[model samples]
Target: MGVLSAEGVLLRRSATDKDDALVQCAEALVALGAVGDDYLTAMRERESQISTFLGEGVAIPHGTHAALGGIRRAAIAFLQFPEGVDWDGQDVRVCIPIASRTDEHVDILSALATTLSDPAAAAALREAEDVDAVLALMAP
Candidate 1:
């Protein structure tokens, strides 16, 4: 599968808290066969060290260098929490979980950053109704 696919785009999700949201993101990545089960722990550790909240109701959750060995392939899972989740004080509606080896994540991050830099694009992603809409908005 590609970095972002229709299967990776999930809408109308809900999380009770930040950790819950992270867990859901990690689980989605695991389900996609992008990362191993231990990836969840790595994601939590990364979050504890620093906040992933990128503003505009979005958060990017990814594993750390230590978790690189568990990655099966590079992929991204997009989860939209319609009710929103509290991410360190900021309310986040989107949680994008990324799994990559070496420096591959940098390129993925750059592309996503560019897409999210536009207010309209970010808003569209947050409120996207289906996977196709999300794919279009996130298209590089």
Candidate 2:
């Protein structure tokens, strides 16, 4: 369970809505073998239950409470939609999809919140040209 790297970061993505963004992010996690196919369904279900949009043009999506069993590893998939997407009532420009087998989800969300809350860091992430830039913003 290492920190998310370039493999989990997607930049300049095109997504129409929250569903599209969620699917794209979840697919990235699946490709990384961080979670099973069931994770996608669980993520959608979780979204339907409550919007993960955390304001600040960001959204943190994760599987349902009961879908923890499908998590094989702790990882995050970040999708940066330059065009933005309609996340419930909020406009989300960044999507962070998380998959974890333990309580690490809380810590990750806390860290992400701290980073995203900073105008400079949030802007850096949205305007980053490469994965390295994005990674640096996340951990800086």
Candidate 3:
């Protein structure tokens, strides 16, 4: 299996706040066996230092370099919130939680950034209804 699998993609989800979304992201990463339990704190610390909210209703939440030791493997989780979560001041429709070894983190972010830079692609991801549709959109 690759970094992203059908099991990692969740659709039609909702969050009351940004922290709620982040908690779910951490849980998903844990459930996927990608990161240690403490990764949630790292995620929160990352968010505190810098907002993860990318443009076009998408947010990529991940741990900071210090937490890289907690990652068991490279993996990504997709959570869709149709109603949108307020991330600081930005409205986020999708939360993409990433777990990666230290060396692979930049590369994964680069590829995902390339794919999401496209307006249509980002929009498609936010509105994707099925697992296959999301998997296809997120393919690197």
TM-score attained by model 1: 0.94
lDDT of 2: 0.83
Q: Which candidate number would show the highest TM-score if scored against the true structure?
A: 1
What shift in Å separates residue 10 of candidate 1 from its native position after superposition?
A: 0.8
**Superposition-based RMSD of candidate 3 using all C-alpha atoms, in angstroms:** 1.5
C-alpha lDDT score of every prediction, in listed order: 0.87, 0.83, 0.88
What's the TM-score of every candidate structure?
0.94, 0.91, 0.92
- CA RMSD, predictions in order: 1.2, 1.6, 1.5
The window of 10 residues in a row where model 2 has the poorest summed lDDT is 103-112
Clash-forming residue pairs, model 2? none
Off by over 4 Å in 2: 105-107
Worst 10 residues of 3 by lDDT: 102-111
**What is candidate 3's lDDT per residue for 1-104, written digit by digit as tens?**
67888899999998999999999999999999999899999999999999988888989999999998889998889999999999998999999899987555
Candidate achieving higher TM-score, 2 or 3: 3
Candidate 2 lDDT over residue span 3-64, tens digit each: 48788888889997788888898898998889987788999999989898887888889899
